[model samples]
Target: MPPTPPEPAAVLARPHTAELTGWGRTAPTASDVRRPTSATELQRALPNGSPRGLLARGLGRGYGDCAQNSGGTVVETTDVDAFTIHDADPASDTVLVTAEAGASIDRLLHALVPQGLFVPVTPGTRYVTVGGAIAADIHGKNHHRKGSWCQHVTSLHLQLADGEVVEIGPDRDPELFWATAGGMGLTGVVLDATFACPRIGSSRLLVDTDRAADLDEVLELMASGDHAYDYSVAWIDLMAGGRATGRSVLTRGRFATAEEAAPAAGPDPYAYSAGVLASAPPFVPDGLLNKLTVRAFNELWFRKAPVRRRDELQTIPTFFHPLDMVGGWNRIYGPQGFLQWQFVIPFGAEATLRRIIEELSASGCTSFLAVLKAFGEADPAPLSFPAPGWTLALDIPAGVRGLGPLLDRLDELVVAEGGRVYLAKDSRVRPELVPQMYPRLDEWRAVRNRVDPQRRIRSDLSRRLGL
Candidate 1:
């Protein structure tokens, strides 16, 4: 007798075959991909799920495997994208925007910025969907003023593994709400989210640029002065050594008032352009980003900035997301891909932070992208990445010598200092260290297991970390 095939409902869920990778271009996984238009449609496929389980993918902006479910069902929410903005109350400095699971920040910003509104918190790239932001609980350059993405979220609709739909928020089903905030989309699939967006007078920012001589000076400058700005980030030249080690270009700013804006904003002050100036070549040879090239690039980048430029008007894209200006920028690293390490150590563990930076510099690994930021108060989500600390994020090509063992050693150092790497950006952390890094893992999983008793929702990251 021939075995029975899945019904149309199940077949619809597993629409097609595809190989998916994260933004890092690392670790490709095969899956049965589906783009369900609505939650009801998505729920119909829940019963016939495979033992390998299922996972929901947003815009695929995550740098690692958190969004990947190998040999399983991967539901895409791009078609489900839709959003509605309620009336704004500038008096209260609040605007409520509700977006579907797939509505991207870029599209939302295009609509909202014209209305003098801006997301309270946005990751480096705006192409990420609202659901992705909620899942990752992303933070922006303005952590000192704002916080993680979930902090501004008032409420959300989540569909559990058993096909049950529930609305969760800070005050409603608070446990599940916080769990899903930074649970890496493991708790459930986010259907919709209503979060607070602040009123911005213009799309331009009043930026202040300062060049820090070295690691200590930059740390001191950010520790003492970050509070004065709504947005702050320091770009470190990782290739520099000795007195120049950790030399940085610190840029800080707040939204420009209508009067402070310049002509660059065009006739309309709130106008925004999400344009890509160039695209990386399809085939870049490996080792193109070696030490000698990176060193030269870093030198040019550092020299381009003014010593102490204050109140220089710049557009949102230039200030917040310079990498977004180039499409497929990850391909520049070539086939093996790259690793982005983002870890936050408590303020008291500055010594560990310095030691880690020094090790990376001395390791002969070539890297141009390194940034440091100061975190504010912690998010309510137990799985949330940020806390009161100093976070450093850097990119290194995978082909570099001693990369794996080096990161592994660095992980031990970070864990010893009571710090943890961002799971959203992680692809290679050891399973045993996960619990040690996130003490509330069991608490988060308890809530997750209740919703997904069989653990039907799983991703490569969940499996890797034994979540």
Candidate 2:
């Protein structure tokens, strides 16, 4: 589908009411959506402790219910999208920009890439908003090198439950700031943020691609050589069995310098384009992606990757957000939707990782999207998801038989090994395991209590997990 046309100003000014669902499309809820055009308007729309609570929703990129508040007020921040870029600091070689929470990363990229700059951290897709990035403390392929998105953020204005906007940062008000980072917007609504961006020579990346034979080889390859690249990730094939299980295509990259890219640069050495190339059909049958079909697709995909390719040039979209090209791709899973299960196990828990992949392969649940990456240090946010470990994420048809028990069992194994699932991508995790997964839950709750004393800011995720 083509993008929705911009609404007329008068019509845009009116409040919106709609049924909302997260990116996963598994859970849907009715909400009164308040599209505030400015920070002042956002503050005015504050719930004042509504019984159903309120949530600040961004571009709706969170895979789960973190952005949805059932039967409550949802403050959609996309209208407050405006940003101003500043000159780079010569000493630090970093440029700073203050962007309203509603601005999508795609918007920022369009403005920055041509100027030879890029966001310090990006998740798999660039469709998320600045506030959504900070809220999730999102990580990327370079997590082993630069860490999560919140680390680059300098300061932000957060509107508390009482509509009082406060400036907070790592040093100024570290407690509240960190609490809000990865806190899933429970503390307050983020209005705007000033973050540091790294300078880039071109909008292309010099990437190296390698095919790993199996689970063991892929793990060894990433652990031994990932330090050489600024970004690294592996597409693992969980359907492969026995000796070929976990066979993967590992791709690692560093930004291509202007000199290296000029040969094919045409007029603009830093030209960038990330427009969607295609859209998935509006509807698909639930059983279209069964184990047999997935296995065949996996085989084809695996075979298509080069066994060893070095320093190949690729655009930012191709390297970082290939999925963005296919709009509404999630609908391919059919009306039943799909569940994205993402979890991180500590560095020493490689055996657990192998076991999980093994179990999933045996489960017969179809999953074409599965990736493995190495995570470095965790951000100081009490609720930050990443840690020094290996994080794996995959999508599975929600209607898979015995899927519940299968994931439930995996949760115990993860907790036993001191790991936790990513809340942003979760849909069906049990509430009781939350504390075990996030040990600093109480510390975060304390800060949340001070900011939202009446618990005015609540999301379906918070209510579900009792955050």
Candidate 3:
């Protein structure tokens, strides 16, 4: 017998499945998924009323529910992907590129690199969208030098809750612009954005590697060596205790010139192949990724990189995203989807970091990947996460029962240090602590009130944090 298909107006609640936090999972909810092919269609689809319940979603790469709507309409922006490049002055070394809010950064980078241009800032993964980047105010390895992704933005096309399209820039609607940069889509629906792309010599990177004995050594090395390189990141051994605690392998790099790149052996000069996308079939057993296993992996990683290197030509993926090479890698943490905890502690809060690491180690919830980096100056975005401080990020499986309390303790430590948590990657932080971490919350709310006066825009994150 032939099965009947759902009608266009059928109100159905299904088990929604998509990638959130790198591990693809399903959340049971009543969400009307709408894919709008054009701006007009998008405007027409938004519910027409005050205090509307709605959310905009991009590539769904956020490690938490920042993009998810519990029982509201989820507007999938992927179909709105369209891009154009304008006449950019080479003398100024700036290229104006415009893309629909849903345009994938990875695709945009692939197009721009051929013209000797690159995105001013990119998160760890390139699968995110221009809108997502702006909503999160994402920073990159070069944040110490270039600042957050919002800094490169020139203009934005935003659709208000009442379905009015408005153009905004730094000089025009400056307050709304600043608020929307990290407003998490609470201000309005981003339709498109314009950014100035940075000119690069070549697609390859000239990388240097170094190893540090402990957390203190890693900080000193980064502070001393940061000026020499435009990009710097460290992989910390979270399980290492005592003298070896916070042992890390640091890699620093910059774009390479034609002379620096190896000679092209074939006709296709820039043909770099990426690995196929794969997913974990099912969850693995709990405790699959413990201290012992992670310790061994860290030891091997630290020993593998060449020590005190001057330069090495590597592909963008190898230099920027080494983890992308391994498909279904998240399965290493088992079926319990992992929670990524990324927090920043101010410059004088070294004790906070040490305490967090010690707590994680003692709790026996050591993460498989622990990253440490030094952030530079702060931007004006009220809800933006980055600041002048030291940041640490980790991935722990959700099945760890006591993990929530441990993270809460860490959050307290972070707040005491005058640091804040990255809302994009958070899942379980207390709502009360949110206001403490982000002092400008009220300012951001004011802007939201002006734009979405009825408080129409909403997401799971907003509901959870009482934003």
State the C-alpha lDDT per candidate: 0.89, 0.90, 0.80
After TM-score superposition, the amount by which residue 50's alpha carbon in candidate 1 deviates from its true location, in angstroms, is: 2.7
Once fitted onto the true fold, the runs of candidate 2 whose alpha carbons sit more than 4 angstroms away are 1-12, 47-49
Top-TM-score candidate index: 2
Per-candidate TM vs. native? 0.95, 0.97, 0.92
Model 1 Cα shift for residue 286 (angstroms): 1.0
lDDT per residue for candidate 3 within 119-185, as digits (tens), equals: 8898777778998999999999999998898888999988888788889988889899999898888
Question: Model 1 — which ten-residue stretch has the worst lDDT?
Answer: 39-48
After superposition, the stretches of candidate 3 with alpha carbons farther than 4 Å from their true spots are 1-29, 48-52, 264-287
Please give the ranking of all candidate structures by lDDT, highest first, separated by commas. 2, 1, 3
As a TM-score, model 1 comes out at: 0.95
The Cα RMSD in angstroms, rounded to one decimal, for candidate 3 relative to the true structure is 3.3
lDDT of 2 by residue, 1-467 (tens): 99987766765576666888889888898888778898788788785435788889999988889999988889889988899898765666689989999999999999999988899999989999999998999999999999999999999999889888899999989999999899888888999999999998888899999999999999999999999999999999988878998999999999889988777666687999889999999889888888889899999999999999999999999999999999998898899888899999999899999999999888877889499999999989989999999999999888888999999999999999999999999888999999999999999999999888888888899888888
The CA-based lDDT of model 3 is what? 0.80
